[model samples]
Target: MISKRKLYYLLSPSMRYSIRKIYYFPSDFWDLISGKRDKTIPPKGLIFIGPGDFKRIGEHYLNIFKEQCNLLPNHRVLDVGCGIGRIAIPLTNYLNKEGSYEGFDIVKNGIDWCQKNITQKNPNFKFTHIDLKNDLYNLKTEQTANNFVFPYQDSSFDLVVLTSVFTHMMPDDVVNYIKEINRVLKPNGKCLVTFFILNEESKNYMKSNSDFNFQYNFGDYSLMDKDVKEANIAFEEKFIFNCIKENNLTIEKTLYGFWSGRPKNESFDYQDTLILTK
Candidate 1:
């Protein structure tokens, strides 16, 4: 039996709707929070949550990730911070028998869930847990709990996708991950990263609303202008472009607002999808 405290914590109001929306299999409150569950599989080809309007959101992002990959039949792909095979599964289905896919994440439950629910009998799909604490990718010996390091050899993958992963990371963590991504990507390899950025449009939206007290950061994650108390510490276009330039990478293509629902403005949108290459 699960404890009431644990159950309540797992099903917090903020996450309850999202969890209930996605999971259909038997996931107790404990299982939801602990991310472990007994074996009782859903039918094959059936999305556990069933196809609905919400699934379209996932599909839209999947399409964006695929467009960024522009994958060849023989290309090897990497899905970093792959959450419960959301993107990884679709990418595998897209590749079919043509290409290979490897996904990595720090959370064991997510990998376990993917292994049981998403991994097909197909030999092309592989999933692994990356431990930054162990310096898995030979990343600097100083390992922090927040860092995620990939364990693949240099130039192993043709394409890497980090959809929505950097949105939750701090600025320092994003920079470290970018360096690690550059290390693993083959020469001429491409990467696509998504971010929740503060743009001129978002700033104006906040400013126009007298009730909303939000401010925008001026091209720096560390500093925020007055009235902006909480800014999403992800990448701004300028910051990301500078990082790419510093790393000697070329901007292959940049697609903005493809999946983000932010309102348009004179300067920018609230979200951006960037595609970079070396």
Candidate 2:
């Protein structure tokens, strides 16, 4: 079993640095953060591109963003798990001058990197460092002793997004975040989230691999193992639908295969994009 301390170590700044290198974040972005350069040029190449080539990978995420968010010029968007400004920066550009964007993450490095690079040109964009692992979901005005603050008032945002964030969270934490999203969202607001879903096909695929196991608890399902075991954490389609129902949100759309499941040539079936309206 993975302990909370091990998870913290994995998320530590030094470990994150190594992970970034392994993931091939732009060298200039790292150089700027390390004070090796006075100024840095934002990377133009696709950061998440795999052996499939850039155009194919770009089309995948672009379509996912468009279908999931249905982004508009006048929208106010909150990106709950903005990592290194991957989606948030590009999304700010996509929204142009008519919209406002805010992003928060558990990692300070991500927030700091975004503020330094993306927020420079997009003055309306903002980033905050918030530790969601702690029970600071309510985010009161005077509760400034935490790692960061959420300045916007309740029901201020038109959309809130938690892309690939729920895939790593415990089931209780996932429910809490759904409640918090409801609290921050306006009556007409929407939320877009992505996750790995464990259905029958996924279960069979895991069984074939012999390196995975599916664990089910009170309707919540996850795959657990030693190496890449945390990837096992997943939700049933009904669990997501029920969470939205309980929160009084309506499902707008669902997009499948954004990341293409395992057995690499399977054509991006692992990711699920959900758009929910309040």
Candidate 3:
């Protein structure tokens, strides 16, 4: 069987993008027609592949935060690129009344759903729609990624989490986000981010993997498909480490993931996770 990544390239870039949007149409239609789509449970078509994946990934992140970040019940949390409350739903039960949560994403539909569902009931959980331009997701925007300021006061959040976000972003944009994360983080605050780290080991592993390969080297990072650079971006490990430190965010720990073809026991998730503190 053809791998998903390989199959993704069979169509032109525009076609691929259109197909993805089209793929989600049925789920959106179901929500409109049946009213069966649970607001508590995000529609499976947007960020996740399966219905259970939303809870599964959210709980996994919660566990990681608790274990590595010492996440407390009263800690203020920020979910960057929070897609349809996949992570926020689980966090609602974990955070105490004193704690608050804020989430933002480039997609309007996800943000609208999250606002009506999550923030309406629990006012502490706020969601914002950032109309940032992205080839695959948001196509038009007045604000550029490097210049768009995070809509929060300085030193606001205790913990900031970004899952599967940087994997699709460019290096400069990622650095700008790191700087923003550093700026908004309270003293001793932690930021947990997931990335496709291109170290020597991972680089070698990708060479033999027919499913996905970071073939286009762009100095600081590599892309699986050159035509659609943002589809899957992987940064050089050293470059990312330096970028993080330069942004004043110290790397507390690095947990490698299974996307590099590492043995199941050796990897934690699909994307390598970095725990950072300012």
Candidate 4:
């Protein structure tokens, strides 16, 4: 029998997304009437990305931002792939009037729900819709991620974030985004991004099949699913480091995760988290 994940990827991107929304709609409807869901949280049917508990994961990142990234209430924040306000909701309570949040996503409905729900209460929080093409998430959009320019001024943000966005992107797209991150950040600004960094240690860990093994080799990067281009990508360590260096961004820290078979209890996240400074 074909595995469910492989079978799911066989369907077109539009069909895959529609099927997920449909699958989760009944529970979301029930939660709406029963008042089991929080106001800031998006309905399950509408959430297009990310894994694990929605509210908990958002709060978890908030803590990381405050504790690890030294995020301040008055600093400007940018979320590259703010899907359904998972990270934005927690930030609303944290950022004071002097601070602001800007997020953009390819999916229109997530942005619509966020603007209607979150932005109404917190005027400082804003969302913009950009229909960019990705193999797993979006396909019909005219714009390509590789050369897309961020609609923002240079040296504007104090902190930039890309939680799980790069994992779904191609190498060229990520390189361009890194350059954009360097451009948009103020002097000494910080960026906290996550990726699957394929270094020696991570390679050793992936010897077992239990972990997230990027078995399909594709030069500098590898894919979890061979045919599904954007399903999950892991970049070689040298390529990632070189990209950061070429973009004039310095690596501040590297926190490897448990996805490559490291002890789960010892890891902070499933993907390797890197803190960079510009």
Find the candidate with the highest TM-score and give its number.
4
- Using alpha carbons, what is the TM-score of model 3? 0.88
TM-score, each model? 0.66, 0.69, 0.88, 0.96
Q: Residue by residue across 1-278, what tens digits does model 1's lDDT show?
A: 85443353344332533454456434454565675643333222222222334334556656765666576756788888775666665565567576788888754555677777666565687888764422111132354534555678888888888865665455667777788788889998888877655556544554555332223444455222222212223355678777778776777876555223335652232346678886
Write the residue-wise lDDT of candidate 2 on 22-109 in tens digits. 6665665676688764333223321311134333443455466566566676778888867656566456546767778888876565
lDDT of each: 0.59, 0.62, 0.83, 0.90
User: How well does candidate 3 score on lDDT at residue 213?
Assistant: 74
lDDT-best of 1 and 2:
2
What alpha-carbon RMSD in Å does predicted model 3 have with respect to the real structure? 3.2
- The deviation in Å at residue 105 for candidate 2 is 0.3
Cα error, candidate 4, residue 109 (Å): 1.3
Cα distance off (Å), candidate 2, residue 210: 4.4
For model 4 the local lDDT of residue 46 reads 79
lDDT of 3: 0.83
Clashes of 1: 1
- At residue 161, what lDDT does model 2 achieve? 81
Ranking by lDDT: 4, 3, 2, 1
Number of the top-ranking candidate, with lDDT as the measure: 4
